[model samples]
Target: MPESDPLQPGSPESDALFELEPRAAETVGFAQLARLPLTELVAPDWAEALAPVEDALREVLAFLAAEAADGHEVLPPPSYLLRAFRQPLAGVRVLIVGQDPYPTPGHAVGLSFAVDGRTRPIPRSLANIYKELDADLGLAPRIHGDLGRWAEQGVLLLNRVMSVRSGAARSHRNRGWEAITAAAISAVADRRTADGGPTPFVAILWGRDAWSVRALLGTAPVIASAHPSPLSASRGFFGSRPFSQANALLQAQGNGTVDWELPPLP
Candidate 1:
């Protein structure tokens, strides 16, 4: 069953607003992440987990606001920042971390490498990912690039730095997002079952950037591989079978496997 929204309208959860933009935000509650505008769109569980890095989040947001004020084009519109958390944190059955948001203007929807469609040519890394997905899941590739379905099924499709300046990849790397997300990584790692064991969620760490969070993942099953970038894909990503492997691990842990076959886009 789909989980009930804890941030329903008119409830106290909706009243807790930590506004990132001057305009009205969503009806969603920020939970413990109420202090950081960057995480305000996340689920209550994720927000609460992010509480420890509130100060780091604040610093990051302030810097972003300042950058915007300086006339820089920050990609992945603010409204899409928390799309990855739409399914809520507690429901997270898988975690896939990317390095940063796409540098192209319309290429990023805030869920890390996912574009709006699978047109003529997409990012090299994304194309590589699709190739691997096809090989691992034994499913024909769809032309669309939207990965929101994966996110809806409890995949935390997060990026190390959630946003980047238009045409400038890794522009926000040195900003405070690393610290804030590091804390998030730690919190997710800390999630424990009734028997005090690691949760069933599987972590797929691609490349060094994503692997950096490995230390914080505790005992969660990890499927580490070379990045699905043209530069490194041939080295390891091509035959990694991460999608199948991740689902296999989840099943071994007594959890439902993810349906990696994405549906066609309208």
Candidate 2:
């Protein structure tokens, strides 16, 4: 099956709302493109090529917007942000597809999730996973540097639901967000490859909600593991090994090792 309700809650209303948004029409059209910061946005080539599928994008956005208007409190409409981040989709080899944005204020910036290395603590499971991997791989310091190094090799960090506005925090809303995330990933996966080839993308699903969307990935080769939170650790989701596993898979597929460049924490 194609993974039901990638958004949290997966309610009928929420889905309907996502279907109504005019993201596609707006993205290609001048008005919508003008709203975004050209420098920060993803380039236009990929999005332009996908213009034929604008209706689908619009539908998803409409459904999301309606849900928010109906008090589902979804994340901010990320269509503009999505367009800005379009560059990665062109030929991205690995995508770390997360669930929704973080619940904390000012963390979700359309496409990026902020994990404050100096302030907000790293999730314990994530920390443990990194520590374990570092130990096994003979890498020391057990810090963000290791993960940062992995990012340089063309690993694109993406959340399923990209934008959650500040002050909109609800468990149910988060569930709805998950559904939106799933829908977004589906959208990207549907894009035709640059050379008219298969879209060879690897997705890393971290956490429980992320894991739940496995069906959406189809045969795209996914890495399903614990959420990297303290809560997940209680359930026995320990391993520094998953990183190595991910690396090995990428190498086997000829994706090569990640660059490990530290992403701006988040």
Candidate 3:
């Protein structure tokens, strides 16, 4: 008995290779292919092509689930795993990284976060930052209206640690999330433009821990700043509005501004 060659046409290994019987080259149609298992119909290279992305996503989800099961709580349920994965990973022009998810449930909707204000009602530090940005860019109350405008300009708002604790307890502190953050930074660094050119993306680090991860970003240039918490803001967090400054830098670099306004502070 000897090991059989998998490439051989009539070998048992060949059956595994071609899970679906070859269509007689006449009856192949979209309906027939749609009914077949993806693994059977797709070329071997197809799986190979997606292997890296699939593997990275699995690693991220597994890490998050394990952290949660280990008593480390995240704001949105692990169910939001799909939504997080659905987010655009690469080619984003501006990247904003915060510390962790807000302790409030249903608040970490992946794309939106609480900012102290009449419109959004976020934390104090966020209010201060917005106020400073409003003055610097001449936008005050309008900043509260539509924060999603940043996303339209290719700004990706993400947290270094996607999980947070709730209520009067700090029991949901993240212990092993730094690794996932590092992985995400790596993924974004490797992302390319649709036309095969290098994507010149800018990253904003809002908190101390978030800013500390700059070493993990490799070649990505990061604009570091104090955390946007009441304590940090009081200590001059908004002294230099990093978001507006980054945009100004982008403008100077030939990337013109979009239809955005930095409203006046209330």
CA lDDT, every prediction?
0.74, 0.49, 0.51
lDDT value, candidate 3, whole model: 0.51
The better-scoring model by TM-score among 1 and 3 is 1
Which portions of model 1 miss their true places by more than 4 Å?
1-40, 118-120
Error of 3 at 152 (Å): 3.4
Candidate 3 at residue 185, lDDT?
Answer: 64
Candidate 3: which stretches are off by over 4 Å?
1-74, 77-87, 112-120, 142-146, 168-176, 192-198, 258-266
lDDT of 3 by residue, 152-233 (tens): 5666666666555544233334554455556666666666567865456777777676777677666665777777677776
lDDT of 3 at 192: 59
Which ten residues in a row are the worst by lDDT in model 1? 22-31
TM-score against native, each model: 0.84, 0.59, 0.62
Residue-wise C-alpha lDDT for candidate 2, range 139-192, written one tens digit per residue: 542333223234335455666555554465433334344544555566556656
| Candidates ranked by lDDT | 1, 3, 2
- lDDT of candidate model 1 versus the reference: 0.74
Model 2 error, position 1 (Å): 45
Best by TM-score: 1
TM-score, prediction 2: 0.59
Per candidate, the number of residue pairs that clash is 0, 48, 14
